[model samples]
Target: MAAIYQVDSFTKLPFSGNPAGVYISDVEQDYETCIKIAREMNLSETAFPVRTTDDNHYRLRWFTPTTEVPMCGHATLATSWVHFTELGIDGDIYYETLSGQLKVSRIGDDLKMDFPSELPFRIDLDQSIGEALDCNGMAYYSTGTRKLLFEISDRKKLEGLHPDFSKMEKLSVGVPLRGLIVTCKGDGEFDFFSRYFAPWVGINEDPVTGSAHTVLGPFWSERLGKDKLRAYQASQRGGEIRLEILDGNRISIIGNAVTVIRGQMLV
Candidate 1:
């Protein structure tokens, strides 16, 4: 029997964060089976725990309903929560991912993830990408993923702005992956608020993306002149994150996890 645990990552309380389905098994499933199960689960992402060098260390792979993603921090955090809190695995847990080794540590009520940094490079804003999104924005940039970072003259523009999904899908085809639209100094609660659209990758909007923060957090921290910052994903189903810029190559992302559902699956 395989056990499936439903957990909400990046929020301490249940029903408040990104929910992920985690599958634990003694034997790892083939790639096709993993993708099939992930599609069936139909969560933002599903994590599979594979054999590792030690019991405390394991390999994890993340699959969206449509395809496999290289890495996912929120799902990784949820995976850690299930292993540590439910399965009673103690200490820092190590996961070998396609993106490389990731370390997760439990600190009090928050789970901190040590992940690699994805720095954004400067790019010119042009009408081509804008036409692709069919939204008016002032500026843009590109992280590992294409980004539309615009400064709104008025915050009200944010509340009323909507992009054409068809245009966004067209824009995504031009770029290697989907693009993210972010507004700086628009929300008073946090440094910035963002909406991720990746139709190419099968996600319209991710509730809270910890991996994306691997790029956004440090970018804001350096600009804000503070090592630590608070982030909010302004999706209808909102989520929050506490980010700290560590050494040049690493970052510490702090968020709480909530276990929403627990069940067993026959494999």
Candidate 2:
């Protein structure tokens, strides 16, 4: 049996944001064990944080129900929330992940995560993808993280998309894709609004993604000409994110998480 923490990331209220399972351990969980735990939890992603010899640094990994992903934002936020609140960790928390070394810090009641800024490379829109999303794409960009970004000129079209998940996966037959990001320019409320779909990674839709913002923070900043931006993920259980572009190609993702369940996984 192992302890498991359920946290609602990118929101202050319960059941209104992306829910993630967090398992913190002194020793690393094996690949099979982590997969089993993630499957049991059945969240979009589960975070595994194994302590390192260093004081505050840990090796962090994320897994979906069926496979492991290179980076996960909500799960990472949930893990940090568990540590800072439940476990009583004090100063900055450091995590070594597949993406790179990540750092989390506390500011008042919110958490700030330092992630690499990836301005996606422009690409020609795939007609099949446009058909799958049922919307005309303004521009398309692909990132090194294997995330595909499709920007639409109209926010209403971005919000009203009903994607065919099966076709979304099939459209990138020869391409390596982790997920598809659909976004548009926001109107007064936020700088932009987005929705993420990842049938390829076993998640039909992600409620609130933090990693996706790394690419978005930079992409929108360049277009809007601002270093600071606010975004909203227009999922059913919506969430908000505050972004700040830092020096040296990095972005700060700021959000609040609420711990909803404190229990043990008896698997």
Candidate 3:
């Protein structure tokens, strides 16, 4: 039996941030089992970390209820948190995932993740997207994460705007989009503000998305003229993300996570 846990990423409190299922096992988990467990967990994404010969290194995979994703930040953070705090793993943890080799280092209570940066390319706006989101802004597409980026004019609009999710879903499938990021410049303590929606991937609204910030980090860095910035995800269950733009087209995401649930998978 493997040990399974539920963790809230990017927040210290339970039921905040983004919740992800973490499955820790020594034996290899197959594709069918991964999906089954992911569906059972029913979080935005689940992290399955299978140990390799190296104690600190793992082969990690992430799955949504409906499909596997190439990258997932919050789940990765949850998995590393479990390893570092719960299991007493030491030093920097390494993950061999669909996004290539990634590393996480513990910084006191916070964890910093070395992730690949995804620079978004500007694309012509789709009118249907405006109808779905009920707002209009610049549109960009990221090849690395397959997330569509939209920059609205104000934070209030970004926070207050409600989308017709059904129409949003239709647009995502028809346009073949994986997720949508609605973002704007923060007017207060945070440097930027954003929200994530991905009905096409079984997540209607992710509370705090680390993967979305891969695109957000660079998008803001260029405009803000700063390598390091603070960001807030304005979901109902909100969360904060600290970002640093790195050389070689990479990014660093920093946050804390709390283990909200723990149990053994008996099967």
Give me the candidate number with maximum lDDT: 3
lDDT by residue (166-202, candidate 3, tens digit) is 8887773334578999999987689999999998889
Q: What is the lDDT of residue 62 in candidate 3?
A: 96
Output the TM-score of candidate 2. Answer: 0.97
Q: Which sections of candidate 2 miss by over 4 Å?
A: none
* C-alpha lDDT score of every prediction, in listed order: 0.76, 0.89, 0.91
Residue pairs with clashing backbones, model 3: none
Pairs of residues clashing in candidate 1: 11-256
Model 2, 135-252: lDDT tens per residue?
8775455556788888887777877888888777788534578888888888987999999999988999999999899888998999999999999999999999999999988899
Model 1 lDDT tens row, 180-225: 6555553557877665665667887777888878777767776788
Q: Give the Å error, residue 150, model 3.
A: 0.8
TM-score of each: 0.90, 0.97, 0.97
Count clashing pairs, candidate 2: 0
